[model samples]
Target: MKLKTLASALIVSGIMSQTVAAAELEISVQNLTHGNQFTPILIAAHDGDSHLFQAGEMATPALQKMAEGGDIADLAAAVTGAGGVTSENPAGGLLFPGAHVDSIMLDTLTMTHLSVTAMLLPTNDAFVGLDAWEIPTEAGTYTLNLNAYDAGTEANDEIINGGGAAGTPGIPAAPGMDGGANGTGVMDGSSNDKVHIHPGVLGDTDPNGGASDLDSRIHRWLNPVARITVVVK
Candidate 1:
């Protein structure tokens, strides 16, 4: 009886060891914007083929929802359905300017790449994104900077009217409390219909009635709107 019990114990220990052998990943996301805020962020560990967003490509329905409405449920669901590990909304809510958020440890033994995306507040269909990045097999720390991309799904009217739905014509909110009111709107038309880099907000000194509701000096940002660091162990 003692020998039989020992054999069973050994079998259980072996099974546990195998489960623990899976790869462990640590991901950190930092908002580099001086005035913008990031909506719920979506981090996924997927295969090389998976991409959260691609430049010059048509934005998916999920991507549109996220970029326009600050919603990440659809994207997270899509990633989860693809046999990928996901950390949804690690920040719990809006990540303010110059803030950082860390996700839970993701065990990605099978998934080999990582992707992340979040909407830039006070803008029309603009988002900070990182497409599929090959996670190094060798354990180490890696850093990357991300750029802001225009969803090209909306016309960027720059009118802050609480419009946070897909196909909306104006910005939803300016969480930084630096926005103006009753502006004339940025442009009357949009020339680009494909995803591309954001041209930055155009604001005039007149806040009560101007071409933009945002302050150009406070809201404008260059490329690489976010910084990401990944540690694999």
Candidate 2:
């Protein structure tokens, strides 16, 4: 499918989860960016038909809560309600630059696909994610690189004013402590309001009064923001 069309079709594509044999999974996640921070990670072994957030589709209220405020309560509930297995917040808190978590393990029942998500802090609605990755039956370590995605539920206002609630217009935070303050917003808002690949952050050098409150030297990141390793046992 074409990329643009896929965005709008995300809701219907792969909407069914295929069940897999019961297997134990050992998962590890690494933040590859130099300046970004990941909120509590939500890892799941789920049927292939369901998703935390589907690209090219509107963000669910549960997903909006996670993407906007770093809260996973509703999404987790939805996943659990769908009979998916979950591992919540293995990092315990924000996973900062170069940080990693290797202690997560899951014993799958009917779950076959793996989905992972976490809000990328200091942005309005940016997140690093893995959407419905199939778990290999053979037991060996598998590596995957994840991308930064926009929930497309909010504008990229680039202001740091602690507005994390869904539909709020500013970034909840800049955990790096190197971000600037009292600056004007960079972009007005996104044209696309569905889930889609993120246009990376556009921070400027002027901290006190730049177009963005984020520092260009510290807050910018390219694609493939995270590296994930999965071990099937």
Candidate 3:
């Protein structure tokens, strides 16, 4: 029994040691949307067993807050608690269209996986995500174009209200100020209760009265709304 206990302790020590090792990584994200804004981005490097958000799965409480509002506090704390390295809001504030933050350098020695998440403004619960992407060990720069995702935490009401908290009914704010007002709302409920690819938004030209507050011509985007470049140094 004593020998078995000793072996277990040694195994745990090995794991803890590996987790403290670091990998040098320079990371950045660019917003490709024409007019949309990305809330503070969260970039993390963790083990394969952890994930910030996963498609086809229900979002966690932390993720729900982020997707519904531009809140990264909870998610960042969660990642740090999970034995991972994280960079929050590298751009200092909203990452505007065509804008990028390239100064993030992560020494993710023990962490082998990478993920990024940030809420897209001018809509409810819409976010861009990269879930548990494996960080390549090879010394090269990797570029990935990411798609928008819905946290499935709120209905895409397309209304801009001051409700940014979790379980709120509307979008908190739209920095672009291009969205309309007096929107009746777009949907009564979310069709899917799991994180999934955003169906894109439906907006009308009317600003005074419309089904959605977002401007279709300005807010809509194709796949790959954000570009991520990771350099393994």
**In lDDT terms, which candidate is top?**
3
Tens-place lDDT digits, model 1, residues 1-233: 99999999999999866643456888889999888999999989887788878888889989999999899999999998998889889999999999998755788867878888999998989999988988887889889999999988998778889999998788999998888888887774667777889887776677777888888878888988999999888
Error of 1 at 188 (Å): 6.1
lDDT, candidates in the order shown: 0.87, 0.88, 0.90
TM-score per candidate, chains pooled: 0.88, 0.90, 0.91
Highest-scoring model, TM-score? 3
Model 1: lDDT of residue 212: 85
RMSD of each: 6.6, 9.0, 2.6
Query: For residues 148-186, what per-residue lDDT tens digits would candidate 2 score against the true structure?
Result: 999998888889989999988898988888878888787
Q: Which ten residues in a row have the lowest lDDT in candidate 2?
A: 11-20
TM-score of 1: 0.88
In angstroms, give how far residue 106 of model 1 lies from its true place.
1.6
lDDT assessment of candidate 1: 0.87
| Candidate number that wins on TM-score, 1 or 2 | 2
Per-residue lDDT of model 3, residues 136-212, tens digit only: 86779999999999999898888888778999899898798887889898865657989999988888888888888
